[model samples]
Target chain A: MKLEEFKEREKRRKFLKEISVIAIGTAVGITTYLICLITHFDIFGWNFGLVLSPLFAGYAESFLAKKYLEESTGAVSAFILFIITVVWGFIISNPTLGFNIITAGSIIIIIQAAIPTATNYFLIGMTLAIISHISGIFKKITNFFYKRYLQLMGKLNLDPRIIREENAEEKYHFYETEPDMNHLGVLLLTLEYLPQGKELIDNKGIYEKREIFTFNQREELKSMRKNEMHLKLMASVKKTETKALYNLIKELKNDGCNAVLNLHMTFETLGQDKGENVRQIIVRGTGVVLADKTDS
Target chain B: MLLSSTSTLDNKKITKYHGLVNGEALLGTNVYKDLFSGIRDVVEGRTSTYAADVQNARDEAFKSMEAKAEALGANGIIGIKVSYNNLGGTMGNTILVTAYGTAVSYEK
Candidate 1:
């Protein structure tokens, strides 16, 4: 969408959220290991390093899932690492651990890491999935508790959660009514892109149009609502690269989306009618001004 | 029940041991779901149908296992190991799942 707005959205809050989640995961993992080491570390049947690998793998995966989103599913890279570790074990064991390669001693020791790695494969998948799920729950609980606390604090002349909600609500806006052409901050940008050579003009123009809508166009709707979901989607944009408006929607949400107006692009084939190297494009969407009261 | 696959739940003390309990289940799917999920994989981020399906099967297996523990008067389940078995390609293309764990009651 709006590259600048998207970049701005991505630059701070998402990064912080990612860091916070990863930090939480890292703390949980490392603390568990530290506690295990302090207490029943002897319970482990295999090398302690084996235990550590999978624990950290799952820990790393929590962040990986967040950072990479859908790309992190199945965690194929971890699988690749498993294969590499096994092969690396085959090559280095005789020299490193003084065991003949492929011998029972080597195999057993290798199995130590291999077993945990394999087990962690399942563990990591499930753990990451559950971690995401749990984080969502944690967020809900925190919001609930925080809201209650804020209300109580307000009666006692406190401003704690109030400030927190303010900061969280800054980037978001909501509108009840469909922003027609008359609405302030609503700009329908009709962009035409003519392809030069075989390469289509990149989405830079589309991104700019969105940025214009966000910082300049969006600020027009200054009054806020608690929910931004009431903001509607009306984009006619399509990309051969994606199934739905997947990227557009995600990027919009990621980039402090006030609302998403469907991108409509029209190509002019008149002058260059059927010219192999020439194509035109247009983009359209509503930039609604969020109303404090009833908008409709 | 305090279910966990980890060797121990974080900070949650395990006060006693109550032996082990297990549950196993096999689930089947139709060609339509399998085909749609296959196509969906290419289109979306997660195949929610398959995830829900597998999760439901796992939950069922765990529930049966918990039922066994409940019968034994146990309060919690720990150190659970879950495994998947396929009865397909000739065995009717069914999915078999097993959940086994030590049943125990732990103090807060």
Candidate 2:
């Protein structure tokens, strides 16, 4: 596909993907919030939106800015993400606020905001700005819980090279959001599943680069759960997140790779260590992209 | 015919005001589109076939309302009110939309 076509396709795909994440995260956050109300069990004293919104907002800003680096991005990027999150929080709470624009009550609310809400947002902003730079003991603490969660969930064995279970929750959220925004022509992959060859491949059953797969064909991918190759390939992608898969595909196409080459290069290298085989899956249009920074 | 959802017309003199004119639209969906929309609801963050379908139904209702006003020899309608009703069993597959306004002849 031409560069313009690719960009439009990717924009739509990313937009769709981000929206699904936001929707699902919001749903879970609200559900969790309601449960908290009923049970009076407040974990860390955070409302549901407060807990999940920042992570999702960060994920989305990283998407729009087309920049994401694990624990390496600077304050500016994190700051931008925090602002996005704050705005989302404001919007989510707006309806409940019931502001009467020109009243004394509004003034009192503003004063109250300057004291608590503003302070809280400021602190949260600072925390988010520095979140990506967490290191030393903080990093170790994070990694410990991460790994333990995964182990508890029976996804991974106890390996010392560890660092994750928020990931499990994220996927559960993703599954809930998948159907609503499924159209935007994105080739979505997850930590658990690979984009199987058979599902993504066009009916021609032949792999050729730049061939547009119909939406129905891409839709078929909803059932393309991971096999051994999918899991193995996911591990080989250097970066393990969904964005990494998007970027990898972008890199392949930028390097002028055909579909056959894209599949082989994507799956084969990842499967090399495991002696795993790649299945045939064809997808149309380059949907979502990780940042394709030419300078890097 | 001119249309305004607000109560008063801007700097216009009303020569004759007719009784309330109304239009109603009822719409349905096929299995495939509904199924597609059901999946779309889960997978998408915003925008859906159902939203589009409802918008279309509302537009059709508005058009019919305007047609009624025009047939009554009124140049404008004001203070329009629109209400939506879901007629289908529990899940609300069918929708009913009703629009009403005071049709009037006015001179600006």
Per-residue C-alpha lDDT of model 2 across residues B2-108, encoded as one tens digit per residue: 88776566577666555345555544432233444544466462255556767776787688668867877889877676766543321123345556666677986
Ten-residue region with minimum lDDT total, candidate 1 chain A: A229-238
Whole-model Cα lDDT of every candidate shown, in order: 0.41, 0.41
User: Model 2 captures what fraction of native contacts?
Assistant: 0.00
Please provide, for model 2 over A86-192, each residue's C-alpha lDDT reduced to its tens digit, 9 standing for 90 to 100: 44434554534343333322232233234535535654764564464443556677779856654663442211111011122233443242231112233222111
lDDT of 1 at A57: 40
Candidate 2 regions with alpha-carbon error over 4 angstroms: A1-296, B31-38, B42-46, B90-92
